[model samples]
Target: MGAEQIRRWESGALAHAVSDPFGQGPLPWLRGSENYFDDTGQVVPWYADPALARSTDGGTRTADDVHRQIKGFISTGAAAPGEAVDFHITVDPPQQFSVDIYRIGHYGGDGAAQITTSPRLSGIVQPPPLTADRTVSCHHWWQSWRLQIPSYWSIGAYVAVLTTVDGYRSHIPFTVRDDQSADLLLVLPDITWQAYNLYPEDGRTGASLYHAWDEQGCLLGEEDAAVTVSFDRPYAGAGLPLHVGHAYDFIRWAERYGYDIAYADTRDLHAGRVDPARYRGLVFPGHDEYWSVPMRRTVERARDGGTSLVFLSANTMYWQVSLSPSPSGVPDRLLTCRKRRGPGKPALWREIDRPEQQLLGIQYAGRVLDPHPLVVRNAEHWLWEATGAGEGDELDGLVAGEADRYFPRTPLPEHESRILLAHSPYPDSEGVKRHQETSVYRAPSGAIVFSSGTFAWSPALDRPGHVDPRIQRATANLLDRICKRD
Candidate 1:
């Protein structure tokens, strides 16, 4: 079948299969209807469904089954190794569980390596209950555990695996970062993950920044939707947000190819802690939509200072979001934005007289939901060096999902050269046909910025045998030169 036919089939199957975080075919439905919060403020949904557990079977089944029901998240999604972080958990039956922390990297192709294990702790578990509106809030819970990250932990994506005596497992992912510099800095879009996460375990409240469904099953406007999503909640579906596909895929590829990569959360950019000058290249991976003013300025300054940027993402730096402290006063823990709110609320970066195109050399053209072929425009460009992709050659499915197009509002930065690389056309979510552009530009500072202009680009690397190898070779070409540059 053609790429378009395959995309139509895959998108449909993924819609139902997307919400399973554990790679399980489907999620277990909560048996309870009435759920009330305990004095500690934890939402308990399992309380109403007492018979949901098959305890009568006893032995291994009961022990093993209880662990599968455990779900939880950290108070702050990202923290330093020396800092202490709180973990909130929900369990069917309160029991002692061990926490195993693993740093996710290109570790021998496994992508994760166990770092440390915590002593078994006796604790009570809180289950999310249905709200008065019958919608679920899994984050309404008390602190279940706290761990002071050891000073020896490496900076990267870390998953705290909760395990019971019966070997049931679940994961809460976080990042550990430091001030030390490296060759390449990978900024994971954790904000985007939490923004789209609605913990759609029962398929009831999978609302996000762009979309939401009301109690009556009616879709609500962005302003009326959940304006603020907390990082204290677990992510919806596979726990790997749509953005993660590209972010992790890039990380795995870079590591396997021997790139000296460091890790940081996007919030680090907002807080002014990330020193872009320390790295030759900065990578922004997948669905990086929301941005704080400081974050934009930091990157803008870095670009001017010769830090090459690789935005393997789409619709990035699109919305302007503000950050506030959580109830715990942890900075950048809650992301707040009203995409459809009035002008008095918050405006997009464009409304504030700054467009992302000014830096990215491209603008948000439109979205492409159906799969389409990426048509190479400049095969002679250095990026297409070894891909064997000729001018006008079609690369199937690399341009699927949201995309950006070359639309420089102002004259190019002095001495900068922008090259249009690919042009792909497709119908969007509304069936309106549109086109997106992929480009690369050289800045005056000798720094180069390349944008794949599609959210699907990164994740496309993970598909075995089906994805085009040209994309991989093109990525390696960018990283090899950028990271090795003076």
Candidate 2:
């Protein structure tokens, strides 16, 4: 279909005029509800029924069942409006399947809005992945179904729900980006997600940058992990990347407040498609540990140019990686991280004389063996305003998972001012005492850099049973100040 025609179809204008095999129609909130649209007659902010989350049936039963049933990956991690994206799907037992597209956002706490649904299409089991040089890549030469993104679709993170005839399902996440400017840009850690993805984790063939199965069916550590990983495969298990929910949690909270924000993948940063300076602030919302030279350079340059930076989780920008093309000659399809220092090889950014603390204001210390309370420090700071938190006040279980801390001896950035927001003590895996310190600083360019210094921070914003009003307010305070929205 033509671009304009697709745009009209997606906007629900052509829904009444033509028969839509894809089931494109008015949104649930718009049916018999005129108030949902703005004065311009456009849908007001695009919300979904909260009941949709409870009713969605697109989850895989188990890891092994992922590939055995139905699983897929998009041809690209991010696409712009009017671009055609191909879906590479595989279904065993040769059945029929359909794809339900959803734009992930707040959506009235439903967390997603259904964009469209494809008709039943034939499904076939694709070829097995190729294992070479310790990399398992599914350069699946399977027939692909292409979907042209409608020009009117809002730019955001999206997922394609793949469901088979007999009730098997999986998900594929991608981003739709644009060149428009906004108050803040949320960068999805897709590179880190792919780094940890051990697709087809069936004990024998699955491999990631962190772990892989040995000949005796035992999991190997990083020393034996795959040196190269491919994006030509689906995510392991239910097709969702680990720690991706952290990004989603922040999204739900930020969108709930009606914050002006845009979205992009990490790859977009590396390719220079996204000029971080165009936005007032750049927010990295999850476990963004892996970094390529170009990615690091771009972000650092942006920060030096007076653009604010926010890291909501710890252990960011630790490992150095390199991106290359796939066997089919697609750029950046293969990610290689040697994790070892050599004359000319990839290694930890710290070992290369550039510590993460220089950019993040804190560096990763160690993993948190158990949950610990985050003790308030510098309570009078602007970030803690309206949070009702005082000196020594503790937020229970706010410091857990991985954590970061300020190192006086490490190379640090030259800043106009700096503050330690939280200083909480926790035990490492070896029972050694360690302290996690949340930090923030103002660079010479007047750009503010804030790091939560704990993996649990984002979860505290929107995750059920973990959300704390104090944290929610503090986060809002930070974003408002950086984006100048307050």
- C-alpha positional error of residue 98 in candidate 2 after TM-score superposition, expressed in Å: 1.0
Lowest lDDT block of 10, candidate 2: 15-24
Over 1-486, each residue of candidate 1 has an lDDT whose tens digit, in order, gives 222122211321144232221111211211122233333343332212223121223211211111325667787756787998788866556677777776655766465567877888765656553332322344568887888988987778777766555434455678888877788999988877677655543323545564544544444545555777666565553343544545656766677777788888888888888999999989996668888889889998888899999998778898888888766676776777767665574457766668778878787776665567888998998899989999999888767666788764543444368788998777777888788889788889989888888766776564333346888888888888897742
| TM-scores for candidates 1 onward, in order | 0.80, 0.87
lDDT string for model 2 (1-486, tens) is 222122212221221112111111322112224544444444432333323222234322322322468878886869999998899888887898888898877776666779998888899888888888679887765755898999999998888877677666577889999989999999999999898877756656677887776765455677787999999988875676767777877888888899999999999988788887789899998889999989999989888999999999988999999899888888889998988723574488988888999999999998876679999999999999999999999999899778899999997898999999999999887788999999999999999999999988887887655788999999999999988867
Residue pairs that clash (backbone atoms under 3 angstroms), model 2: none
Q: Which is the leading candidate under lDDT?
A: 2
Task: Report how far off residue 75 is in candidate 1 (Å).
Answer: 2.2
Candidate 1 versus the native: TM-score? 0.80
| Winning model by TM-score | 2
Off by over 4 Å in 1: 1-68, 127-140, 164-169, 200-207, 211-213, 217-223, 343-346, 408-415, 429-432
